[model samples]
Structures are given as structure tokens and as C-alpha cells.
Target: MKLIKLDAIDSTNDFLKALSSQEELDNFTVVTAENQTKGKGQMGAKWESESGKNLIMSILVKDFLYDNEQVFNMSVIVSLAVIETLKSLDIPGLSIKWPNDIMSDNKKIGGILIENTIKSDGRIVSVIGLGLNVNQINFGHLQQASSLKVICNVEFDKDSLSFLIIEKIKEKIEFWETNSALFWKEYFNSLFRRGIPTPFKNLYNQNFMGIIKGVSSVGKIQILLEDDSVSEFDIKQIQMLY
Candidate 1:
């Protein structure tokens, strides 16, 4: 694995993409920045933070998945890797929220963003971006946010922590290649509020209560409505009010 540490950058993903276009990209390469001027999140939301106080990195991988449906499973892998890494560091109450948010005591500690590039030969390239709160103790206006320093009551070395996560990801990737089904099963078991009644909103902005009933093979969220009817929803089809 190659590590490129930057004092400051626009976004690690964008930097990696530029390298890919220039044929300078390598598999298992990691790009870490002291700050991201324009970090992005799911649905194009801005990822906000102060420079040099958090973990902002992007990892590149080639041929991550052959089937499109398997793409969502990447979140499972990444989330598990993060949770496991944190636990190994003695970070208690660390768990993965649905779809790839790291939660420490029901508060967000980190997030994952995975994107892909399709090559002409039909191979897929994956760019996995992770933002982990390390040294930051407060988020000012962002509620429900916490960092390792605040949670653990001690400062952390972001560089060492980043390498630990990378090692965990490599191990998880190996596990995924041989036991994908098992991984999915475990993921559903660890899913946030699985099989528990929760309020959710459908795409049409209809709000209702339902129980999360595991995810499908394709990563669609399955919910059992109040009337005992089971329904599945694709990404962006439903939003859970957690």
C-alpha cells in the first residue's frame, strides 16, 4: 500500500481521480489530506470539517465487483472494517449504522463514500473515501457528531490510526472474496435498529412506521410495515429517521 500525505487538498477522491486519469493511480493506494476544501458526501452533500483535525483519506482498488448489485455490499465491508478497527483500539460502543456510518453510542463518528470507475475492458475501479473524526473534540454546529478525542478522552495520532484502518480493510477485502454471503448475514445482524420499529419516509415523502427486516442480496433495505406486509426499497427509495 502506498500512502500520499498532503498538507491540504480539495478532496482526496478528486485527487485520486486526477491521478487515475493521468495513469499515476495504483491499486491499494491511499491519499490522505490535512483538510479537504470541497469534500462530498452521499447525494452530493458537503462534508465539513476543520483542517488537520480529522481523518480524510481515499483508497483506490481495481475490479472491486463484477456485478452491479454487489456494489452496495462494499458499504458493508467498509463499515465492518472500520468498526472492527475501532474496537481493536479499545474504542467502546462502536458500531456501524445502516448504509455505512460509524456510530459511537448512537452518534456519528465517521462516514464512508464509495464510488467506481468502469474501464474499457469492463473492469471496475473503486475509490473508497473515509472521514473519521480523530483529534477534533467539538463540531460546533453539527449536532450528533463526536470524535475519538472526545469519546475516548484523549488525543489520537491520525497517521497511525489511518494505517490501522487500511490494514483492517485489507483483511476485510480478503474475507469478502471468499465468504460474501456470510459477511452479508453478519452485516444484517449488526444493522442499526434491525427488526425494531422505527419511523421512516418513502420517496413520495410519505412517513410511516416499520421494522427493518434485513437487506436483500442486492443491498435493498427490506422493511416490514405496521400491517405486517414486507416491502423492499432501493437506495434513495426510503430514509430512516434515526
Candidate 2:
């Protein structure tokens, strides 16, 4: 577990990607930054965090999955790892909103963005980006944002928290290839709003009500619609209303 700490960087994922391309990097090589000039998030949304007040990190992983078909499994493993790490810290009401939004008490606390590259020899390399609000107390206009500090009302050591999360992710990856089914089961168990009526907005900009039934192996969320039918939607096609 080689760690690289930067005072500032454009994006940790980009830095790690460039490094991996230049040379053979060790597995679980982590890059975390105190400030990001252009932080990224799922769906092109900006991951806004106060400078030095959040965990902005990206990890390099290789040989976790052989091909692209099992890419969604990366999400399952990483999401479950973060959930379990937070649960151990006594963060209450933690759940994974579909895909990979870390939520506590129905408020957004963290998110994950995974970028994979396939080499000519058919090997896959993944850059797992995780952004978690740690000590920040104010979210100017973001109505749905919260932090561990606000939730627990105590300051947390960001260094210790990040290391614990990294360890948990490694633990999951260690047994994933053979025990994948078990990881999927735990992921669904920690899924947010599972089997509960929820509101959603589709790509067509229409509001509809549905219940989350299950997530496809390819990462599409299965929702039970109003007409008693189950439909699958990708992240771009559906937005779960909090």
C-alpha cells in the first residue's frame, strides 16, 4: 500500500492514471489530495468539498476482474467496503443509494466514481475515486449534503479514517473473485430504500413512483413501476429522488 499525499492536485484519479501508464504501479497505490482544482463526480456533477476538510482520494487496482462484464462488481465491492468501514465507526443510518452514493440518515455524505482502462493484453486497471465529507460543517447552498462531523458532532482524524477505508477495500478485494456472490448479497442488503416506495425522475423529465427491487449485474437498477412492471435503468436514465 504505497501512499502519495499531495497538498493540491487537479484530480487524484488523473494523476494516478498518468502514473500507472508510465510504469508498473503496485496494487492499492493510493493518491489523496488536500485540494482539487477540478474534482469529479458521477454524472459530471462537481464533487464540492472545502479544502482540506474531506477525503479526496483515488486508488489503483489491477486484476480484480478479468473483463468488462464484471465491472459493476467493482462498485459492489467498494461500496460495501465503505459502508462497513463507516458502520464500524458508529455512523448511524448508513446506506448505499443505488450505484454508489454514500448516505446517512438519507443525506448525501460521500460518492464513488470508478474509471477502468483495458490494456492491449486484455488486462483491466481501475481507478477508484472516493470523496467523503469529513470535517466540513457548512454546505453553502447544497441542501442535501452532510458530513461525518455534523452527523457525529465530533471531529474525526481524516488520516486514520482514510487508512481504515483502504484496508476495508483491500479486504473485500482479497475474497471477491471466489466469494463474489456473497459480496453481491451484502451490497443489496445495504442498498438504500430497497423494497420501499420511492420517487424517481426519468431521462424524459417525467416524475414517477417506483420501488427498488434489485440491481442488475451490469449495474442497471431494477425498479418496480406503478403498472406492476419491473424496469431496468442505468444511472443516466434514472435519478432516484431523495
Candidate 3:
């Protein structure tokens, strides 16, 4: 639980990755920035956050127990941890969108990006980056993005919330070692719009209605289409439409 706080950084994940490569780091070593100049999202999108107004951080998970193939399980663990942390804060309508977007009332509030380093023998060291909109009140034209202040009308202490989230993640990792099946079940049940008819557009720009049937163990999204057939898609292969 070693914490490193920076006034600003290009990206916390990048900094942690570089540090880990340079020397052995403790598990759950945290790096946080007050202003992330180049915060990243899934698919290389830019994560916008007002300076010093939100949580922009990365946690290094050294000696990660899971191998490369169980990366999705790692996602589930992290997402669940964030969700539980938000719940403890009394944030309403919290749900985890597919992959790792944290949503509340169907709007985006946070996201996670996991980068893994694999040893030749197949062990893993994971760098888990998370961005949670905390006290920021404006998203400019980003209508789908909201923050804890916007949603709950209350400002939160960014540092306090960040530490709580890290603790929750550690708890999840410990629980996962003994009860992985339970974790998977809870992850699916916490999915946003799970089992609900939703609109999506494929890579070809074809729009259709489908029910999110849950993600595969490998992290592919499974959808039950209008034709009563099932299809699995990788990230960006299918887009969820609001």
C-alpha cells in the first residue's frame, strides 16, 4: 500500500509501468496524479478530467496470481471492487458496463484500463489504472459522462475515496483466491443492462437490438440477438448505443 502522489503526470499507468520495470515494487503500490495531462481510456480515447477535481490513479499488482489467459477475471475483480466502493459511498444506480466502465443511472462515471507484463514462465505483473469522476461538475459536451458531484450533488475527498477503492480491491483479490466462482456470479449480476433489450451497432455500422447475455471468460461480450441467436464480439467489434 505504498502511495505516490504527483501534482501532475502524463499518465499514472505509464509512470507505474516504468517504475515497476526499473525495480521490484510492492503489491498495491499506488500512483496518483492531481492532473493527468494525457489520461487514457479504452480504445485510446482521451479521458477528460478537470485538474485536481477527480481521482486519476494506477495501482501496481506485483506477483499477480493469474496468468495472461485469466485477464478477464482480473477485470471482473477490479470492476467489482470499484462498484463495491461506490456502493459504500451511497452512490445510487451503480452498475458496471461491459468490460470495465463504471456507470450510474446509465451514465459513465469511471473506467478501468489494465496493462499486464508477463514473464517468460507465464506469471504476470498487472498495472491497473482507474479514473473516477469525483468532484468535477462539468464535462463540456460530454453528455454521457457524469461525476459523483454531479450525480449525488455532493463533493467527495478524492484522496480518501482513492484509498478506500484500493482497500476494496485488495479485499476482492483476497476473496477471489478462495471464492472465484462467487466473484464471477456477482460480476455478471452487476452488469449494466444485463438481460435487457438494448441497441447496439456493429463495426459495419449495422444497428440492432440485443440482450447482453454476459461476457465470456476470455472477456468477449456475448449478446442474444433479436433472432434468438448468440454472438460474441471483442472490444470495439460491437458498440453499445444509448
Best by lDDT: 2
* Candidate 1: Cα lDDT at 89: 83
Candidate 2: worst-modelled 10 consecutive residues by lDDT:
61-70
Give me the overall lDDT of model 2.
0.93
Clashing pairs in 1: none
Descending-TM-score candidate ranking: 2, 3, 1
What's the residue-level lDDT of 108 in candidate 3? 97
TM-score: which candidate is best? 2
lDDT of 3 at 150: 92
In candidate 3, the residue pairs with backbone N, CA or C atoms under 3 Å apart (3 or more residues apart, or in different chains) clash, namely none
Off by over 4 Å in 3: none
Ranking by lDDT: 2, 3, 1
Q: lDDT tens string, model 1, 97-183?
A: 667778887778898889888777777788999999998877988888899988889889988888888887788787787988887
| Tens digits of per-residue lDDT for model 2, 96-174 | 9989999998799999999999988899999999999999999999999999999999998889988998998899899
Separate clash counts for every candidate: 0, 0, 0
- TM-score preference between candidates 1 and 2, better one: 2
Model 2 vs truth, CA RMSD: 0.9
Quantify all predictions' global Cα lDDT against the true fold: 0.84, 0.93, 0.91
